[model samples]
Target: MSGKVFLAGAAGAVGAALTPLLVESGYEVYGTTRRLERMDAIRAAGARPVLVDIFDRERLANAIDCIAPMIVVHQLTDLPPGLDPTRMSDAVSRNARIRGEGTANLVSAALAAGCECVVAQSIAWAYAAGAKPYTESQPLDLGSEGARAVTVVGVAALERWVLGVNETGGVGTVLRYGNLYGPGTGRDTPQGASPLHVEAAAWAALLAVQHMKGGAFNVAEDEAEVTSEKAKREFGWLPDMRLPAQAAQ
Candidate 1:
């Protein structure tokens, strides 16, 4: 398998943390961001950043084709920085669009580029209200309120389009990450099961590139219903997969 990876949303919270890991893993990364300023930092991390938006189908397809990557990892989202809930209603609507419409454009671009594998980030907390910790096969709760309803619908769309890809050479890998925090993200630790640090999230994406396969795996700590047994058994993924915390010192 080729060691080249196309990391869409290369400047995101998870993307920022993942970039260093990609460089260290010796993968030629073609990262994308909507802004040019983000390219400088990405370049510093040994990535070739392409300034393009996921919503632009033509440009997006061209960018991917130019890279000719065997693997595509998507961590795109429209969450506001700091995640203030003052205007959460508006934020939810916009984020939902990213999960739904934005993801659709990515699928089209990946298919047009003849990319074989796609791995994307999905929320773990979007499962239905029945079980304490929802599994991958469980359905999402669509009967939610104003903002939550949009969130569930958007998540459902993103997952469907990613996993629905079928062809002679096409496979989708969805990594359902738990509540992300720590390093570059504002919330260092928040209340949630399956909590994952940004560093671990990055590691999981790299693992996907290393092992190209189809399946949804929960990427999170071994807290309650949030387990990564599938990921651990399949791709050797670990929730605490990080460099030493003292690396900061």
Candidate 2:
């Protein structure tokens, strides 16, 4: 099942973790990054670097069209280091825009390229107050206010756009990752409910791309806040899995 893969946000935490896995699995990867400085890092991970902002529809479309990958992976995000409380007000809006508009653009480019599958990053903590452990069937917290509302709305848009690819004969898989920690995430230890390591999140995306399954799955630790049974059973994902030291760099 190896073929070309277009990875968005290649310089990001999860993206950096996922790139080597894709290459080692025999997929030719083209990773996207907005910064010229990160190109070498993507190359080091064995993926060709593509410098294009997700908001630039023309360049994004052109890049994807030229690559014409079999799968598209979206690991894009916008958040402050350590999720500093002081900067969160503005960061929340920016992050929402990334999840909403950025995801929309990526999906559009993917569909235009006739990609077979699209694997996207989402969050596991967005579920509304409900049972202790939330599942993929659980509804998102759409009725929240202020920052929470903004985040939920953006998440909804992202999931909708990604899942809608199925209507056009393409597979769409969303991994609802829990609060991430570990290298490059600015946290060395787990924090918050359903804590997940960055490597595990990356592995989940790889599994989705390999399985080419459509629908959402919660990618998180075996905790009470969210249930990861779906992902474990469907994708054989291991929440504690970490990338090999050399690959993680």
Candidate 3:
């Protein structure tokens, strides 16, 4: 029940937004990145930055130990610049591995550190074909083939790790965010499946630490592929998230 957070991928878009929120929420936040140079802004946002690669299991675990956080947020991804779709074929594979192997490493660290809660970032488009606006109870298309199959494997692995985690120390809440948009985000609303603003996604993570139930909730607008009613009812997830007026200036 202590207010300490270990945040991975702290230099990324969602992490940047979340850092300030964690501080404002009265939680002591520890942020991590692969490069110390990328962490200055995170420090400015009131997080103690630790530079280390998430793929390095020992290094990641040691960093978690040093931080001694009660909560861990897994938002790690290896997206390249410009949100370029041209290179998606390659990026998709890489991202899948992160969701699979990377998630396992994070889960292990969480277990070792005896963290209480784990809130992870996941995609909303992986639900198997159903009526529409797929619910959390719906099945994921893990049986997909080709590149789509590869993507599903990653998504399933990430979620499995996040939701399958035990609740003794803490529970893992998998927030299946819609395609992210808004400030500093790459994919716009019209371009992806059940798109949500980046600010909203960060807000979901912030609220997850405080109010989310330990389960999977879709966080997105009322798009055709997924439904966020659970998040709306449970964590007050806002698909229509926005920037504050002063910050928008």
Best by TM-score: 2
> In model 2, which range of ten residues has the least summed lDDT?
240-249
For this target, which candidate reaches the highest lDDT against the unseen true structure?
Answer: 2
Error of 1 at 155 (Å): 0.7
Report backbone clashes per prediction.
0, 0, 2
Give per-residue CA lDDT, model 3, range 43-120, as digits (tens). 888898888887899999888877778899987877767687787789899999989998999888988888878999
Give the per-residue lDDT digits (tens) of candidate 2, residues 74-182: 9998778877889889988987998899999999999998889998999998999998789899899999998899999999999999999888999999899999998
Q: Which 10 residues in a row give candidate 3 its minimum summed lDDT? A: 240-249
Which tens-of-lDDT digit does each residue in 78-194 have in candidate 1?
776776667667878887888788888888787877888888998888777776566777777778776788899988888888887644468888889888888666677854766
Cand. 3 Cα-lDDT: 0.82
What is the TM-score ranking, best to worst?
A: 2, 3, 1
Give stretches of model 1 more than 4 Å off. 166-168, 244-249
